[model samples]
Target: MNGLNTTALVLLIIGGINWLLVGLFQFDLVAALFGGQDGIIARIIYVIVGICALYAFTFIPAVKRRHAVE
Candidate 1:
């Protein structure tokens, strides 16, 4: 995958892990590491993760095309 795709995947993984922690233990890893949930850095991370999730949608068509070619 290209760099941007790789980055989006990594960030999505991080966001997924953070959600898992929040669901299981009521913890917010990003907030905990950066500051509170309202902290600027933490908010930025959240926004980036959300955007990456949207970007991930683009992969659906690519995957379909790849499978069709095989």
Candidate 2:
């Protein structure tokens, strides 16, 4: 689970950077690296990143636990 969390975090960071680039410069690093946006590879990359983002939800610290520290 730790490994999975780390992997998901890394992918999430990459996705965050990609979104930052898109917002600031209208660039898409993944699409360029994997071909064009419609390319199968690019679509797969996007899908994986999205899934990683979803997986990242598991890493969220529980609010109750945070307040339970003694």
Candidate 3:
């Protein structure tokens, strides 16, 4: 709802797309931007994305449906 949450969502979406690309084509956009997969910056970006993903776990659509019924 706020900027931090929105930013986290965007990062998570980007992470998801990057995974899709990797799974389908062995490509990784985050690694490309932060420099190869082994780079510290790339690893940090990955960690942030991972954290964002964990943060988003509570926001999944199925929970929204359950909450709506209550």
Candidate 4:
């Protein structure tokens, strides 16, 4: 579970970076690497990023419990 959480966090960071680049420069790194937005590989990347977001949503609460200071 820890490994899964780590992987999700890494992907979320990647997705965030990609979005930042898109917002700042109108560039999509994932599309560039995978052959454009319409390509299957690019779509898979988008899907994985979204799934990682969902996983993070479910994970944060437990993470806080595990790391609580009190």
Best by TM-score: 1
Clashes of 1: 0
lDDT string for model 4 (1-70, tens) is: 7899889989999999999999999999999999999989999989998999997889878869989965
The true-versus-predicted C-alpha distance at residue 47 of model 4, in Å, is 0.2
Specify the poorest-scoring 10-residue window by lDDT in model 3: 54-63
Q: What's the lDDT for residue 20 in model 1?
A: 100
Identify the runs in model 3 with alpha carbons over 4 angstroms from their true place. Answer: 60-70
Which structure among the candidates has the greatest lDDT?
Answer: 1
Off by over 4 Å in 1: none
Which is the winner by lDDT between candidate 1 and candidate 4?
1
RMSD of each: 1.1, 2.1, 2.6, 1.7
Q: In candidate 1, how many Å is residue 41 off?
A: 0.3
On lDDT, the stronger of 3 and 4 is 4
lDDT of 3 by residue, 1-70 (tens): 7887899999988999999999999989889888899999999999999999888886778678989999
TM-score for each predicted model, relative to the true structure? 0.92, 0.84, 0.80, 0.86
Better structure of 1 and 3 per TM-score: 1
Which sequence of candidate numbers ranks them by TM-score, best first? 1, 4, 2, 3
lDDT of 3: 0.90
